[model samples]
Target: MRVLLTNDDGIQATGLHAMRRALLERVPGIELAVIAPDSNRSASARSITTRQPLAVDEVRFADGERGFATDGTPVDCVRFAVLGLVGEPPELIVSGINHGSNLGDDVTYSGTVAAAFEGALLGIPAIAVSQQAEHGRTDFRPRGRGWAYEDFAAGARFVAELVAAIDGLPLGERTVLNVNVPAGEVRGVRVCRLGRRIYRDELKLESVAPNGRKHYRIYGAEPGYHEEPGTDFEAVADSMIAVTPLGFDLNHERALAELGRVDLQAAFARSIERQELAHEG
Candidate 1:
């Protein structure tokens, strides 16, 4: 199978390298191509380049493997790979083996998820893989046992196997799989939904700059973990691979029906007219 691999982490990240090596070693008869950001573009959420021209360059690995690097977000990398870089679209696009977990609300802001979303948008089957770890620590090599490189490699191989077995699969319609593996020996796999994350009061107003303007830096307090029974967070905390099926359409159909009673369209039109009249005055 032809596989296009990409990541939110920059092209040079250890995590990205690990995943690439794993795919090549584990999956047989696989044609691999990579297109990733030139630098880290984490938490960039499906954003596309419009204001500036995208720059893409050919990159060659030490083993003579060729890929492309782009000065854009992960979504842009996927688009470029499918439409511009590769001669043909890949059968599958796998994103990440990301440095951090993209669970629950994190998926809404994740560039890793966004890259997979872009692939799904273009009628390609895609999966986003992430590993949960303690924040700020760089080297995951020490954690390399049940929840380390080898474990993630095993998960990637399992996903490939699953895709191969499923026939007449729906490639289009923005279907994606978000997979998060716990850091350590995994218990098993769980089909889950988005989990909740609770953050303590970490936002603080620091000091101003030279111009005497007030500035604030949002610092994170110690992250706390809460596991609700059937959610992804619970599965991960139990050292299981959490797989959540996600769709790109964000519309809340029930809410649309409830909101229809408010005559919001006419209200918005009148509000715009009032603003225009005030501007003229």
Candidate 2:
């Protein structure tokens, strides 16, 4: 199978390389097209480049593997591949082995998950993989000098196995599997729902420039999650891989049914009647 492997982390990121190595070793007869951002685009969400034209460069990895790097967001990488840059549309899209865990409500702000969403939007099966940070480490970046590819080996291996067995999995055409791997030993895998986040971020003014520009910090602290049962956060806390199926449908069916009974048309007519009465007076 042909898989489009991309990530929000740059092409040189250790996590991405670890996944690449795993796919090459574990998945039989798998072809990979690696395309990703030239630099880190973390927390970019589902954003695509519109104003400026994107540039793609052929980059050679330290292991002598060549891949494409673009000056665009993670979504753009998927679009770039589907739009014939990689010869044809890929059969699957695997994003990440990301630097940090994209859990709870925070997945909405993750470029890793956003890439998978784009692939699912295009009728392709997609998976977003993330690894939990070490204990008490809010800084999701590499520790000390840097992280070796082995730091992400466990997550990469699991994803490779999942990809190989995807034919037997019951996945919808427009569904994305959001996977989060624990830092230490793997307990097992759990299918769960998203947990709510309790944000403690405070807005603070850092400094004022001579040009009257103010610098403020809002997301200064790491957010916490509710300890709910059968949640993605809860599963990861117990050192298990959390797999949450995500869809793009944002409609609230219950609210739709309730609002359908309201007299919205009469309310609109009343507003128009009030405007006419005011004009005459």
Candidate 3:
């Protein structure tokens, strides 16, 4: 199977390297090509370049594997790879092995998740993987942390197997799998829905600069509210890997129907026509 790997963390990120190694070692007969951002662009969402031209560069690893890096967002990297870089589109698109968790509403702002979303938009099956870590903790040296590379590799292998076996699965138009691995040994995998998290404190504004500028920072507990059972957040908190299916199309159908009850469309059309006539005069 051919796979396209991309991430928001840039080509040099350790998590990206670890995931590439794991895929190569475990998934036999897999052809892999990577196209990623040249620098970290986390939380960039699904932005695409429209004005400036995107730049791509050839990159070589120590092991002689060739990949490409782009001066663009995660979604842009996937778009370029599918439309320009590869001779043929890949069978699967795997994003991240991200440095942190993408749970609940975080996915809405995550470049890691957006990469997979872009692939799904292009009609390819995709997966977004994230490793949950303790906030404010820096060293992810693997150690015997149980959430080490070995454990993550195991989970990755399981996900690969599932993808291979599940035929004709409804990959909703613009659908992608968002997988979050907990910060310790995984109990097992759980199919879940997005959960809610509430932060303890609001961001605080600090002192103003001599040039009359204000600075602000977010400070608070890792303390927060969590969702009830059967949610992605709950699954991770309980030491289980969470697999949440996500989609790109977001429309409030019920809300639209309610607005339509008052002949809103006719009113909108008349208003637009009146404005156009006024402008013409």
Candidate 4:
């Protein structure tokens, strides 16, 4: 089957390479097309470029296989690939084997997860695989800084197996598999719910330039978490692989139940009438 691969960690990242190698070794003869951002696009979410034209370039893998590199977001790579830039709409889109875990609420801002989200949006099954952050050296660039210096053999192997397993239990539309592997060997795989992560502390103003372009640093003091049952964080903390089914729909189902309490239609109508009255006056 044809598979499209991309990552927020950039086209040159080690995790991407490791994933490619592991899949080739384990799956054997599966076709893959790599299209990714030219540089690190971590935390970029599902943002697409509209202001300027995006540029695409051809890049090489370690094995000399050519891949497309674009000066755009991770989602852009998926969009371009599916639009016949790389050929056809792949049956599956595998994003990452990322250098860091996309646990808890971080998925809201994670470009790694966003790439898979885009694929799911296009009616294709997708997976966003990540290794624990501590296992790699991505302290600065999220998942792209120093992945080449770290060993992704174990994580990549886990992803290869996970991909095979997911082939059978295909997810519904608008959903993607959010997989996070432990640092070393995975004790087990647990289906989990998304957890909470709150970054504590104040923003540190690092420096102010003469031109008044102030530079600020938000140093992570310690990430805080809520202890919840069957969460991705709990699974990862227990050194097991965490597989969370994330959905693209952002509608708050529970809150929708209370929608009857507010008169949104009347509110808008009243505001519009008031504006019309003022305009006529």
- For model 2, residues 25-129, the per-residue Cα lDDT tens digits are 999998899999999999999999999999999998877888999999999999999998988889999999898888889888999999999999999999999
lDDT of 3 by residue, 1-281 (tens): 77888999899877787778777877768788899999988879998888999998999998889899999999988887788586677878889888778888778878999999888888888999988765222121123343345545655665566555434566676789999877656778999998876655567888889999989877444534465888988887887888999987789889988877888788889999999999999
What is the lDDT for 198 in model 3? 69
lDDT of 1 by residue, 89-205 (tens): 788888988877888777888899999888888878888988776423212122333334564665666566655543465444678988887765677899999887665546688
Give me the candidate number with maximum lDDT: 2
What would you estimate as the lDDT of candidate 4?
0.82
RMSD of 3: 4.2
lDDT of 4 by residue, 1-281 (tens): 77888999888888898998887778755788999999988889889998999999988766878899999999989999889987777888899978778888878888999999999999889999887766422222243335453457777787787666666785788789998877755688899998888776578998999999998878656566787999988888887788999888988987897886788999999999999999999
What TM-score fits each model? 0.83, 0.94, 0.84, 0.89
lDDT at 158 for candidate 2? 94
- RMSD of candidate 4 to the truth, in angstroms, is 2.8
lDDT of 2: 0.90
Model 3 regions more than 4 Å off: 135-151, 163-170, 218-223, 265-281
Give the Cα-based TM-score of candidate 4 against the true structure. Answer: 0.89
Clashes of each: 1, 0, 0, 0
